[model samples]
Target: MSCIPLTQKSSDFLISSLSQVNPFNDTSSIIKWIEYKNNQRFEVNKIPLSKIENWYFEETTGNLRHQSGKFFSIEGIRVETNAGPIKQWSQPIINQPEIGVLGILTKKFNGILYFLMQAKMEPGNINKVQLSPTVQATKSNYSRVHKGKVTKYLEYFLDKSKSWVLLDQLQSEQGGRFLRKRNRNIIIEVPSNEDVPVYEDYCWLTLGQIKNLLQYDNIVNMDTRTVISCIYYNCNGNDRYDIDRVNECIHYSPLIEDSPSGYYLDILKSAMKKDEGLSGMDDIRSWSTNLKTKYYLDVNSIPLREVEKWRHDEFNIYHEDGTFFRVIGASIDTDKREVGSWCQPLIEQIESGVVGFITKKINGILHFLVQAKVEPGNFDILEMAPTVQCITGSYKNEKPENQPKYLDLFLNPDQSVVRYHALQSEEGGRFYKEQNDYWIIEAGDEFPVEQPENFVWMTLGQITEFVKHNNYVNVEARSLISCIGLI
Candidate 1:
């Protein structure tokens, strides 16, 4: 990927905006940002938000006690596929019909752009609190709390004061297995002179600052990356390499380095000459929408049927064949949150899954080992997927000849060939608290590559480029790439 064209002054402005937070700034405020939660909690004389007697928790199923009546029941979905009748968990999809919005509130100050991030909490996050979107409100959340009162600056992005810029969109959630999900992605800019009050839970950050934080695992949350990746900064039109400018960039830039940045830029220029870039987002929209539609049009699978694998009581659910997930009920209370009190269901994983990619250099450029996976929910019957995605410890079901392509290489990974090895989470908000151990495995000329009926090895530059335009690279693949430190 060539450097998304940034001028010298703009680059400097971003680097300068990335200063460390001051601990003592506004120390007297009552609302606690998670960054200062420990410091505030240790203050022996601190004031409490509510009387302890007023807060409590209770577990309710079809009708749980002291729980929100909104999300009440859980059931199982049986989908008849070519493989078999796979029973999966099914719950209430989005409560409201209108698409929810996961928007970033940003502004420019002194020649630099700044993103507004919230220190928010979800019921299923591994950590109690993590960095979240400025406006992660659902259609229900907006109408309930923000419509008439409480949501002050929310008007600017909603419909009133002016500077709202939503980009080429329609980003979907990793199709909640048996369920579906999507949200409108917004990238807005408010005027610099506008005196927008910064809330206790919100903080401003620059692009450079955000990229720096990505180096450390999970600092910049997944929602943030999904939206940021939509940014199209490839606006330079010269269509030629400027070696002098590249050298100048290495001296003062925050991320650009001489050896790799320059070398990779040259590689991209030469490769792009041979590649036929996407027509635009039109192709992407079609690919995502028609994949499954195409699948149903061609192949015949087992039909969907309600089965006994799952049991539903008058007010609760139980799974007879428990291989997927377990649901637990909980009541949540927090003093510094937008919705300080609520009840919701949480998903807990029974076992961990594995995600890995096999890669090697082909014709002097990096090419990844890719797979074609057909999920019940895929728009097309089968879409491009990660090299190795299987439940941990179970790839032996292959019929001697049709086993998963590179199962052996991943099971026995050499440290020298592995790029990243860490446990990454599924969408905490939706999935019942599950995570997969992610890996990036490598193979070389010594280890021969295969071109099965559905697999192909493509250059790294090609993969990254296609991702920006469509669903060519699935979320699992994007998650692995987000961990890659290379720009």
Candidate 2:
């Protein structure tokens, strides 16, 4: 297969990521627009699980399901995995069998690519509104399962005749909460001369502008981040360009120099340098494959009422010890959604989480420390995850030695080593007020190149390549990588 066309598109994306100036709206203007959307009439309040409209618990299996059985259902899954400390357990998971579309529309303006973003409101959002993908809808919603307004700009994705596909990949969502749920993380480029209509809630933004907003907390939603993370920017794919020549093709705007200690420049350099990684792609793949073979994940469906240690009341169903998350009900009323009013079940975490990635310069090229982790709901037995991905309750009272590998480094990190830190949210559609502390830490010079068997050092290019395929990179890792602010 030829990689020439993809390499050219990758180069264009890199330039857009570096360029700070956008022809349409500045970063501040985008913020003001989001604030405006947030002020619109939207309300969500917690109600009893038994009282949610058009949803009921199955009498036979005790599973929470929608009346029409189109959207999604809350079911119980018994998970037995050898990857983590816990061997077997049961929890409530979102059973959405339908694949969703998390697509971003793009067009070229003055040789720079601008992304179309929407200021959408989810029922469970803490901020009430955030920047979402242009079309974030499940197959059920797009096909009028809910019998509501049609999703705007969905034709470009459904009928490929209208646009050129730049990047498209099927990516997984939260494995812990979702049962092998995947979404189409796609980016399509429309011709410059196409007359695409712009609505009040949607706007065009450069990749640089989007990256700049990622520096803040809960501004860019999880769907947007995951879709953006699938974009691989290595112009040297298929050996099309030599190392020096590839560097020459990369142009960094002066705006990147204004960052603290030139960290943005370092990130840019790391992403563009596709060659000379710490480990070869063959080795990385073999390592992952071996992990997959070594570890085992067996998930079986069970009745929700039969789950162990979980208790249910009229309002919610939660673990007796208050561990990972709880299933509750929400009554939502919003003027902006496809359906004006609806009630559904939401998963509220016991506590906020910490998701971090540690990077180091290996042979003058930056490499991210990725762990091949196995969760119960993973489609495959293994997917590359962040170095530290854990909820507070998972290891709060555990001994320091028993905690996850490299957990203490982030817990008590040096201030200077912290490159990017923000309080980002999970998907607001099914999660309620759930936010996590996302971090990018630069490892000290003393950090060793050798890691555990399950962990490997990979360049950003390598990770991006894996992300292009299905079920290789987990959503948490994708979300963290999307926050790499090049601007």
Candidate 3:
């Protein structure tokens, strides 16, 4: 809610709390432990083209046009194409629907809340491990391979009779990006005095402790951050904005402050709340309805080579010579998953990237520098994107026009940045072994500005109002704001 520098007390609290859970500082050991458990019977084998059956390619292009299972087969289409009947692509789509579960287990200790977090390992993670949910169950998690072994503490979350659930919501994955994957995100609170199981790879952290982790890249996984973003102060049903009330909640966050942004921060806290709980894209019916009040995704596809301002090799798409990303295909086999996993083409970044927004207080109002951007997968033709969202090397590339806007301030920080961090990207499920760096650069009134045709400055209130609508703020911009990582 604020972008002020951390006070000495706040800084020491973060450092001390993290030191208490030192083993989890770097997740290498945790990853190894997970892999050790998984390797018992689960395995993934790369099938040669010869071993694959019930599959064939078009003679003209050697592309997989369509395929089917014994029971069912659905043709695929380029997600960007609005006018075409569904067509298939080079990689195969998972025929079965994939279900992922996100569970956040919490408890109130001495009148303050604490969350149970695990140093979870995911195959696609850049850091190999991160602070993940207490129970992050994909179909592979609860499948036959585990032999009905319920994920730890999962029974508590699922057993309506046992635990009290604070939040529950269904969120859709990126349709253009991810295959048919959806997750049921849940939050449960146990009794303060109850003795809950804690594993060696797990730890209890306060929200302030969790916020400190956000300062690092890939330390707090996307699922954890997204789930935390959905937790709002207004949801407590006592939405008072008195200075006394704000001071009381200071224990919940390490960034201790009093009477800073007072009324506006309260407005933001209330606005983010939804009776429906956390969501990925367009879950708020009112938000979605308002978004369509003007524009929607009028998508159409052209050849990768034909997309203006881009270049494509036979195997990849690039801003310039593989500097940003490469398009590749793989045969996936998480055998315990719903569809048991299948091959698909996905975007693999040339290098990890950053998505940043630079904010300045101008004329006594906080204003965010946002840009109008158009991406191949963007639902709307153009949305308000981050000021600088590009791979690290993009601005330094030989291609002059490909340079990102306002990247200099992000990379070279001075007194302008009140807070900044290289945060982690979401899972590699659709991104193909990729993670991004996110930055929030704060510039008080002292910062100067130049407005371009495609760029504009808006207040936190304005941005929050726009967020209620879909696509106005692209994911890169929304993610930076949705989580507590904003001005």
Candidate 4:
């Protein structure tokens, strides 16, 4: 025989001729043969070759009952598929709903060949497994051989609607088999019409939420220092890179190295102007400073009082025109104090019925002592009755009793001492002693020089001056002889 050089077409013809001679027909018989080989090789006592052969005979001959008992026990065998382990019973049968019969056929049949038959018979209804997007994207990026073999044919199946083509088949070393590219293993395909719009909507909604949070005055007006510190503490050096790259696109610029204070102020002013609804920057700066200080103090186990003192010192930097800023800062400190220290004073006041009162005014604030006193008298002396009194005097005053007193007057500018005296007049008219002599005195006029026991005296003036001068307001003076007791 002459030697003939075989071309590509001739080689294919030869292979086709051999395949026709020993064609892959009768999947059940082939699977039974494979199972027999596996059983012999692995010594798997669970499914003997004899049982598989009988199952093949029953399936091919359409007489299933003969090997029912033997094949029925193999129904639960987990057949490995490219997608995952599918129960043998889950294998679809041609025009048959009996899962048990299908399972027997699967056990005795070549799984790949049976799957092809099922796919052909079911057509559109067969499962179209695919890889996840991440896997698909990765696989799309690079091509690599899997399991020591190159995938040549990229076979796919169309779903019912024919909208998506799923990668369902691949050429393996063994033969043509179901494909499961790792990247494509988890993929789910949706109609392009539905998924594209939904993804866009999700992105829009997410952006909207972020925009709304940024629109708030409190959030937008937050101090740049505090915000920067938080970003640094929370994100570390990563924030610097992010602020430069990501935040820059969003119009959030980082401070320049040599940026003047005026630049920051202008930025703040521009931000406020852009969003009229936002709180003033100065106001928010004060608030943010206090808030940051509080947060640090809370986290570091630092005392709140110490934090407040520091805040107070910071607030004192601004003048009166900066009162708003100062107040915001001080209010935070005061609120913290009230929350922390208010209970002590409340308890003391409830128990003792006497508490120091502090009042605030534009000119200044005042602190006074509240005293509870009782009077003992039978003549119904109004001056000696139990009263709630406010004792105000200079801190230098050692005796509060010697301080000037005013009655029934809410405001007084001057400090003066006055004496009240009464004299027993022979005539019906009222008399008072003056300079060691008895003289007639009117009701509203100043008293004479002499002092009388049966009278009341009161002094009115600035508390500091009265205390410094040792001025005594004779609020009330009654005759010791006329009253049985004095209080």
Q: 363-431, model 1: which lDDT tens digit per residue?
A: 555566666566544444555667877665333443644446576677778888776677666665545
Off by over 4 Å in 2: 1-4, 236-243, 252-261, 273-275
State every prediction's TM-score relative to the real structure. Answer: 0.69, 0.95, 0.62, 0.11
Candidate 4 local accuracy as lDDT? 0.17
- Candidate 1, pairs of clashing residues: 60-64, 62-315, 291-379, 291-380, 292-379, 292-380, 347-432
lDDT of 4 by residue, 220-339 (tens): 111110111110010111211122332222233221112113322222122113112122324433433443333211011122122221122321211122211111110101111102
Error of 1 at 104 (Å): 1.8
TM-score of 3: 0.62
Better of 1 and 4 by TM-score: 1
**Cα lDDT listed for each candidate:** 0.50, 0.86, 0.52, 0.17
RMSD of each: 7.8, 2.4, 9.0, 45.1
Q: How do all the candidates rank in terms of lDDT, highest first?
A: 2, 3, 1, 4
Quality of model 2 by C-alpha lDDT = 0.86
Off by over 4 Å in 4: 1-27, 36-114, 117-142, 145-147, 155-487
Better of 2 and 3 by TM-score: 2
lDDT per residue (tens digit) for residues 1-487 in model 2:
1122877787778777876687589899888888888889999999999999999999999999999988899999898888777789998889999999999999888777889999999987889999999999999899987888999999988887778888878899988888999999889888889889998789999888899999988999999999999887665656322556555555443332233127766675666655568788888889899888899899999999888999999888999987888999999998898989989999999889889999999887789999988887789988999999999677877887768998878777899999899999999999999999999999978999889898999888788878988999999999999999765
Clashing pairs in 3: 76-87, 77-87
lDDT of 3 by residue, 243-325 (tens): 34344444445433322244345334333333212221233334434434433344443333333444434444444544545
Clash number for candidate 4: 13
